[model samples]
Target: MNDHAPRRANRIALMIGHCAGMIDLVALPVWVGTLITRYGLAPQQAGLLATLFLGGAVCASLFWAPRFQRIAPERVAGWGFGIAGIAFAAMTQTSDYGAMAALHALAGLAAGSALSVTHGTIGSGEQPHRSFAMAGLALAVFGIFILGGTPVLVERAGGPALFKVFAAVMIVAALTSVAAFPRRQGATEQGQRSTAHIDSTVWYAAVGISCMGLVQAMMFSFVERIGADRGFGVAAVTGVLVALGIVNLAPAPLAALLERRWPARYVVLAGPVVQATLALIISHSSEFAPYAGATAAYAAVMIFTHTFAFGLIARLDPGGRALSATPAMLMIGAAIGPVLGGTLVQHAGYTSLGNATLAIATVAVCCFARAGRTRAVLSEA
Candidate 1:
């Protein structure tokens, strides 16, 4: 095989992994209610199951990332996907809540292992930002398919059947992973080098990532209520959601095109400002058309910010050490968002929630600006 073959393979692996990871994560929202209904569990307990799954994934990703050099990434990812497929399928065999949670946790760990491999592939690429954007685009396309097909599947065969679907997808992903993700020598070499100090750029990116998670989750978690409070009916709210999902697909390609002409930093900096502005508009708008427009803008900008941040991290640290911890930051921020946002909405109101999101967005913008400036100065020096 040609030397360039591995790079091409790695790109394919990343695309598959991104799609699989998105399906695994997004499936939770559809199943959370089903878990409560079928298992006769309390709402809190059902939520805890989902949380435990995410917690396990984050911990596994963190633990396995540093060790990728020792263990071949392809091996790790292939086996991880196989194991996850088995675990997901096993969930259908048990009705016990404990067993379900345990199985889901195992799935999470395997999923994380697979995810680390894909991320490392992207981070080590020549054009990491472009690779990340492509990955995002792949996920968005897959998400649209899922959104269209899942409701029909659920109606025909209930929620647990979705596990079987995920399992089949995982199995397919596992089969291709070995060919798609060859080991990269640069990653192994970089992993062996000693590191003593932290980069300020990494911190700025981390905080921005955390803020992205926080505001996105907070807004999404209560989007329906925001619409309802504005006196929109169920059909109108559903239309707005559908519109947002469809519109969200545009950003990755747009960002890819824009980044080729303008600095990627501009895209990163613009995202938060755009999202904050849209949040304020959505919160204040009572008209359906205005609300839909603002929501769509928020979704598009949200994708840009997240993809840019992850791509930036990869470009800064190709060894994938810092990039490995990003998912944890996101999980932590997302886990906190609902609780804090709920409290603010309860006591203060939606206006307070909007203000809080704006504050976070401002901080993210400042961090991105500083990080970009620091990079410029270092390059000049």
Candidate 2:
């Protein structure tokens, strides 16, 4: 009935979809731990399973993104989440490594397809930075539930319960998408075909975001194990994760507030430095206090910086095609993170992750620097 109502509903739907789609960010620590403790998998084996999931997501996103304007995003989003729901439901039924691996890939494909559409729509908003930050704020709240609850659920019901939760969340997203997913303007969609194809800047931003994702996912996937190996018990470790979720709440809002003050370029540049520093501390610290502090703050770097990058890219590419590749941009490096990190931890040590983070962070900074300042990027606020 009101003009603002549809936009509000769209934002809410995007938030729900994001929470369901980005499960790796919220559940990786417990997910990896479950694979190791419950299924008797080696660290690399467990990390490979995670990698398979992200790789599938990357594949799906890259395929669907360029075709975004050609298709009905709502239908695609609904069907994607539905398929993911089914896959995760099946995942709850098996302990077989092969079966689980297949299911994880299927779920990632569906989830990535859905999420790319979700992010594209958000990028099409009047203020993409604020929209992304809003979605991220919701994700942070969801992270609180996930970070606090998943370990206990696994403790009581084993790893299958984790898939059950994923299934439920996906099912809910599927349902909401049918009625709430917003469609882009037809004239804009028609015009996007001609001009939006120049993607050099988009690719650079994507690479920069992906590098940060690599560091985030690598350290995140192992935080639980790292803490346990250092002799911190489950309660203490989980407390840090919960604290991490709580800390996540601030960055999005902070990014939103800073939009008027800080230049997106400077924010993007600062992100990798903060990310690598926190990651080094998180991986190398034997002390619980330092590890807890660093781990709690680490993810905030990506969240805050990515809020700026998402906004910048949306400004750079108004057609939404480039923004539609959100999953691929974020997940390409993430796909390698777990397996690479596990290999490093296996042969080298946890401390090696710090070195890896530094390397990745340097790459991210370089990419972000090249992303440059468009007139739109400079005019943010």
Candidate 3:
């Protein structure tokens, strides 16, 4: 009982840290407008800041995460969160665009380290699918909480003051890492050696994830406008979004249950196909009900696919190095998707937008399927 108690506490702590890091990333866009107005910076400058942060995160995940097997994940995660919190706190003192951008990148690097360690731990666990599902649940709950309160927080506290809260959250994440990460089995770092080889499938998985991200983001970034174009009012669109949030919460658990009963390969393969079909349905439908239904279905499939993919990568490479790249690939895909969607919408309209995303999703689905086949061939040989 005593041994089990610590392990359980560690899991909870790790989940909290993961949730905190995700909140920080997702909440930044809410503050971009504030940064522009407060600093007298151009829109491009604000965008550049975000880009730098993401770039830092991707770099850290690539360069730092692989070393986690040697260094204790607990220590790595704790220091990362601690330093990131300090950087964010310093950000509150700066109004200079250059200074803020640099600090934000620093924070991003630290946050990425935390994320890499957390993901590594989760993905390499006994039940990777269920672990990821729990993560999705945590993210869904945190997202709902923040989305509900963000407007009020900004209005009452003003935008800049929220940085302090972000800083506090990072500190809490750091503290929680103590319980969440594995304790060192040996006193010497040299004793903690890892011998796992990097699998070729990792790169394929990264490509597949990027393609999925592109399709999902393209649709999501312009969803509100798409509804507006179809004659839906702001209220109706928002109502759908709210309903979609509720809908998104269910799939994680369902996927977790499915993981227990079905093969992971089938679960992963089905996601993109279902999402592509949903995109097609949305494309043909003009009515609010159909659009809303398609949107909700897409949300569910997206989560299911992501959870499966992340788990698959971790299971492929137990060292967690491969999973580290997941966030970077997803971000890269999402960053580019909106530009493509915007251009397509201008030239070809919503139907083309759907078709374009569907086409990309098709490629993504094929990538995963091919990867699966390749894995099977290698196993047989």
Candidate 4:
């Protein structure tokens, strides 16, 4: 019991940190809605503000990732979340758009810094695939919580209530992490040493994952709009979003189960193709049945595929620096997706978005294939 307790506590802290780091996905709707309704910002303005958060996160990830070996992952995580909590607390005091914008960026930077190290530490664990999947599962559960509860809380208490809730979450994660965050494993038994530099395969893998992120953000940002534009009605659209959230719970465990059965390389290769197909369906389908089904399954691809990718990258680079840069790779495309998708919709229409996804998906497949070829060499090393 004594030995088990600390391990259990470490997992919970790491899991919670993962969820908090990725809070932007579930919290984005509330953030944008609050900005538009409470602060009277235009949609474009709200989007740019959100982009500032993502931009800050990307910058932090890129800056911190290279130093993964030098810094204590737990210390970085604790300080990052602590700073983020302060930023969130500050947000509750302001209704000024400029002030809120700066706070969002600060929160994002701190959160991203914590997230990068958290992912790095996980990647250095005994079972990287299962560890990342567990983190993914926690994020899914957290998603349901935020979706079900946060909006109602905000409705009753106003937009500032949302920031208060965010602050509280960050503080809890910070305290827990500092108290119990686990140390990463030393270099692998197979002689995978901690190298300052990773090879091209890791870069290829990162590019492939980034392409998928681009597709997810580009299509997902407009899913409700697509449904509404096609006369799916409010009830139907809401049902899809609700179903989507619930369905998200399955992918992480499923990926863990399939870790041995499915080759990670094949999964990475297949993910973007599957993602592009679903995006096409979501973008072009006039009928509700097809659109709802595709929209619900859309995010699952990234979650499931990323679990495998994380494991594979950890094996290829035991130093953990590449995995630490996970946030930057994921968010680089995401940061640009909304603005670029909107431009495409404004100029070329929804089909153009589908076409774009196809092109991007092809690029992802090619990159993954190149990475796969080298995996035969590095994964064994």
> Which is the leading candidate under TM-score?
2
Write candidate 3's Cα lDDT for 282-364 as tens digits.
Answer: 76689988898886566667777788777667556755566655566665665455556656766777788678766787778
Model 2, span 257-376: residue lDDT tens: 888788888889999899999888988898999999998987878889999998888777876778889889889988999999889999999999998888888999998888865565
lDDT of 2 at 15: 89
What's the TM for model 3?
A: 0.78
Q: Give a tens-digit lDDT track for model 1, residues 1-381.
A: 122435656677778876775453334333443564456665456556666555666777778766645567778778988898999899878888789889978887787778776776566545666777888787777765554455457557876777788888788778878677666555344454314243668778677767766676556555556776678975676566566667768878877776556565676788777777787777677788877788756656766777767766655665666665655656555545555655666677667767888889988888887766656323421
Candidate order by decreasing TM-score: 2, 4, 1, 3
Better of 2 and 3 by TM-score: 2
- What are the lDDT figures for the candidates, one per model? 0.67, 0.86, 0.67, 0.81
Backbone N/Cα/C clashes per model: 0, 0, 1, 0
Candidate 4 lDDT tens digits, 1-381: 011223878999989999888887655655655665667776556666777777788899999987877777889999999999999999999888889889989988999999999987777666778988999999888877775676568768988888898899899889988998986444444224665457779999999988887787777766766776689975677677667778889999999999888888889999999999999998888889999999888888889999988878877787678888998888787767766776687678777889899899999999988888874433442
Give the number of the best model, judged by lDDT: 2
Q: How far is candidate 3 from the true structure (C-alpha RMSD, Å)?
A: 4.7
- The TM-score values for the models, in the order shown, are 0.80, 0.96, 0.78, 0.89
Model 3's alpha-carbon lDDT is 0.67
Please give the lDDT score at residue 227 for candidate 4: 72
